[model samples]
Target: MKQISTILFSTVFFPLLQPVWDKEPFNISNISKPDAPFFLEDAGIKEQGAYFRQLPDPRIKSRIALSLLKTNNEKAVEILENMLRDEKNDNVISDLFICMYRLRDKAKITYSERIKKYMEHQDQLIRGYAAALYFIKTSDAATILTMLEKENSLFVQELLWNELASKPKSCNQEDLKKFLQSKDSIRRAGAVRVLALASKEPDSVPKLKKAAEDELPVRIALAKALKEMPDAGNELIAKLAEDKSSIVRALVASCAVSDKRLKTLVKLSGDKDWEVRRAACETLGGSKSPEAISALLARMNDNYEPVRTAAEDALVKINPGEDTIKKLTEFVKSDAHRDAAIRVLGMLGAKNSALDILNVLNGKAEDETVRRAVEALGRLECKSAADAIASKSSSKNPAVRKAVAFTIGRLGVASTFKTLELLTKDKDASVVLEAINAMGLIADKSFNKRLNEIVKDVKPSTSSDMRAYACWAVSRINAPTDGMMEEMKKLFLKKIIPMEGEKTYDADYARAAAIMALVEMGGKKNEPSMKAAKSAISFFHENPFKTKDEDSITLKEYMRQIQAVMNGTEIKPELVPTVKPELVTGKVQ
Candidate 1:
C-alpha cells in the first residue's frame, strides 16, 4: 500500500518537476501581488509577500522565503506555491525546493507530500532537491548517502554533501572516507574539511595525504587540515611548499608557520612569486629565531615594494639587539637604505640611535633624508637636540623651516615657543601655517596678541589660509579675554562669512574655521551664535566642500565638533585643544 501511494504521488507531480530552462524566461519585473483584497491575517506576511513579489531575481526571492519561513510565516508557503505555479524555470524551482526543505521542520506537513513526489520525479534537478530536503527533515543520513553515491549531477551531489557535513554528529568514518575517494573534487574537499574538524586522530593522516595528491583545492584543504592535526608529518608540507602552483605555495607558507621546517619557510622568502615571498615574510615575522631575522633582512630591499615592506615589518617584529642595530647603522650609509634605516632607528627607540640621525641632519644629506632625520628625532623625543632643531628655524629654505617648526612643536620645549612665534610671520604661507599650528600646541598666552594681529590683518593680499590658521590658533588659547572673543566674532561675521560663497578652496577653509571658532565661543547657550552656527552647518552640508587638501583634516574635525555641540554632546577628546604634536610637511631639518 505504501509503494502504491508513492507511485501515485509521483504520477501526479512528475510533470511539474520538468526543468524550466526550455521555457520562456520568466519576467521577474512583471510579478505583482493580486490587487483584490485577499487579506492575510498576519500583517508581516502581507509585507513580506509584497516585498517578495517586487524582487525580480529568484535568488533574492528564495532568501526572502527562507526568512519568512524561519519566522513561522505559513503565508510564505503560499507565496512559494504561487511562484511554483506561475514560474517554469528549473533553477527557480530548484531554489524554491531548497527554501521549502530548509523550513520543512516548521512546515513538514505543508511540504511533505510534495517532497515525496519530487524525490521520485524523473528530472535529476528535482530529485536532487527533494533528496536533500528529505535528509534535512528526517536526519536520514544513510538514505541520503545512498542517494548521493548514485547522484550524477555535481550540483545535486554538492547539495547532498553540504547537508551531510552540516550535521557532523550524523557523519561516520566510513562515509567520510568514501567521500574523500569520490571522483568529485568538491566531495573530496568537503570530506577532508569535515574529517579535520571532527576527527584529529593520527590514523586519518594517511587518508588526508592521499586526498591531498588530488588537486589545488584539495591540497589547500589538506594544508588547513594539517593545522588541526599537529601529528601530520612535515614531509607533506615540504612537498606542498615546492608545488608548481604559487597559490598552493603561498597557502603552505601562510598556514604552516608552526611546522619545525623554518628553513623551508626561509627558502620561500626568496620565491620568484611576490605573493609567496610576502606570505613567507609574514610567517617569518612571527618567528623568533635568528635565522628568520637574517632571511627578512636579506629581502628588505626586494624589488617589489610590498615584499620589501613585508620584510621590513618582519625585521621589526624580530626586535633585534645592538648587533642588528650596528649592522643597520652601517647599512644606513648606503643611499638605497638611508630612509628605511632612519625609520628603523625611530622604531628601536634607543637613545644612542638619535646620534646617527642627528649626524645625518647636520651633514650634507638630501632634503628628504634630512626630513626623515627630523622625523626620527621627534619620534625619539630627543629634547637635547631641541637647540639644534631650533637653529634650523632661521634657515632661508621654507621646507627646512616648516620641518623645524613641526619638530620643535613635537619636542615640546618651552624655549622654542619664541621661535615658533617668530615663524608665524614667516614669508612663506605654508611655513606660517605650520608655525601657527605649533603655537597652538604650546598654547602660550604670550602669542595671544600676535595671533590677534594675524587675525586682524585680513587684507586682500594676505592669503586666506594664513588667516584661517590664525583663527584656529586664537581658538586654541585657553580663556581668551572678552575683547579677544569680540575680535574673533567680528573676523568671522565680517571677513570669513562674506567669503563663504566664493567657492574657492581657501574660502571653504576660512568658513569652516570661522564656524568652529563661533561654536567654541558660544558653547550651547548663546542663542544668536547658535542660530548662526545652524546656518553654517546647513551651508557646509549643502555646499559640501571637497576634502582634497591638507586643511580638509582640520575642516572635517571642526564640522564634527560643531555637529556634536548642536546635538548637545561633549566634544570628542581627540578634537579638543591639546599639546599633542602631529607631523606636517613643507620643510626639512
Candidate 2:
C-alpha cells in the first residue's frame, strides 16, 4: 500500500514541480518543482496552461491527456509527442494521436515520420491509430494503403477504411483504386465504401454494384449512399432488393418506399426474412400508389407480428374504410390473426364489437388470447359487458382477474361492488390490487367492512397496495375510527412515502393508487403525507401513465384528484357524473 501510494502521487505532482522538458526526476535532477495544489486548482478552474503542465498518473493518463487536447493546450503537444515514442501503452498512444491530430500545425514534420513507423508496429491498435492520424492530416495516404495490405484485425481495418472513406475527394484516389483491386474481399469491400463516400463520381458505380452484391457491410454503405443520390439511389435499391443478405435487403427495402420503388418493394414483401418483409410492408404503407395498398393488405396475415403490425398500421394510414374493418373482423375469427385483430380493433375505436371480444374471453381462445381480449374490452369501455367482466373476477389466472377488475371499475357499476370486494382476499397481489381499485370506483359503505379487514391483515407482499386501497375505501366510507387516520398517516410515512428506491417488482400502478389513497385519507390531518403526495403528484404530472396500462392511467388521475383535495380543489364537473362523485363526496347517498 505504501509503494502503491508513492506511485499514485508521483505522476500527479512530478510535471508541476519540474521544468517542462526535464528528462529526469524533479527531486534529484536540478529541475524546479511548482506548487502541487495550485495545479489541481487550475485544472478545476479550466486554466489550460496550468492543467497541461500537470503530469497525469499512468493509470488514468488518457483522461488527463484527453482533457489537455479538449482544452487546446499548445504546450502539451511536445509532451504528447514524447509519449508517442514509447509503444508499451497503445491506448495512451491513441489518446496522444487524437491530441496531436487536433493541434496539427503545432505538430512538427518529424512527428509524421514517427506516425509512419507506428503503422508497422505489429499491433493493430498502433497501426489503426497511425492510419487515423495519416488520414486526418491528409498526408501519407499511399503508405497507409500499403499497410492495409498486411493488416488483419477486422475492427481495426474497418476503422481505417472509414477514415479513408471520409477523406477529401481530391486526396488518395490512386490508393483507393489499389484497394478495390486487392484480392482480399474485405479490403475490396472497404475500397467500395471509400469510393462511394469520398468521390461520388460515376466511375465508382460499377464497383459499388459489385460490392453491394457480394458483402453485407459494403451493401449497407452502398444502399445509404444510393439513397442520398438523386434518383440513382432508387435504382440501386431496386437491384439490391434481391440481394441474398437479409439485413442489406431490409435496409434497401425500407428506403425504396420513400423513393416510389413500389414494384420492387412489393416483391420484397415476400422476402425470406421477417425483418425484410416488415420493412417492405412499412414502405408499401407510405406509397400513394394504389398498387402499394394492395400489396400491404395481402401482407396483413404474414405470420410475423412485426409484418402484420406494419401492414395493419399501413392500412390505417391509407384509410380504406369499411372494407378494411370487415377484413379485420374476418381476420380476428382466425386463430392466428385473432390477437392481432383485437389490438387493431382497440386502436380503431371499434367499441360496438366489445361483445365479440367478451365472447372470445369467455369461449374457446387460449389464455394469452383471452388476456388481450379482456384488455381490449377494457380499453373500449364496454359498459354492457359489466356482468360478463364481473363474473371473471374469480378467474384462476391472476392477469385475467386483474383485467376483469379494471373493466368492472371502468364501467362504474355500483351493484358489482360485492363481487369486487370478494377479490380483496385474492392471493395474487395484482388481482387484489385491481379489486382495491374497483372498490374506489364503486364507493359503497357495504363493502367497507371487508376492505378494512383485508387491509389490516393482507400479506407483506401486498401490504402497501392493500393499505393504500383501504385508505381510499375508508375515505369513501367516511367512517374514520379512533386510529384510522393515524394508521393511514403511518402507512404513508412507512410504506408509501418513506421507502424510496426500494425494489418492489409488484405493479407501480398499485403503488401509485396506494399513495393516492393515503393523500385522500390524510386529507386535513395527515399534513406530511399530504406534502409527500403533492411531490408524488407533481412527479407524475408530466407522464402519469408511463406503463400505457389504462388502469395505471386511471390511478394517476386518482392521485391527481387526491392532490387536488389536499389543495382545496373540486372535481371537474364533466367527470363528476361518469366517475360517480359520491365515491369522493363521502356522504351517504
lDDT of 2 by residue, 1-589 (tens): 0121111111222222112111211111222222221112213323332333343444355665665543322445555666565535667677667666666554442466667777676667667767677666555556667777788888678877766666635347666767777767778777766676665553336766666566566677676555444444555677888787887788777763664477888889888899988988887777756677667767766778889889878766665556666776776777777877777676676776677777787787666676777677867888776776677766678888787777676677766667777777678877877777666566666766676665455345556546645666665555555344445433433333324556322333334344555465557475655555565555555544344453343344445545655667765521211110111111222
Model 1 poorest ten-residue lDDT run: 9-18
In model 2, the runs with Cα more than 4 Å from the true position are 1-120, 133-152, 163-178, 197-204, 215-217, 224-232, 282-296, 304-306, 309-320, 415-425, 430-458, 463-485, 494-589
Mind giving the per-residue lDDT tens digits that candidate 1 earns over 199-233?
64523467766765778777776666555444444
The lDDT leader among the candidates is 1
Which 10 successive residues of model 2 have the least lDDT summed? 576-585
Candidate 2 accuracy as TM-score: 0.61
TM-score (all chains, Cα) for each model: 0.57, 0.61
Per-residue error for 553 in candidate 1, Å, reads 22
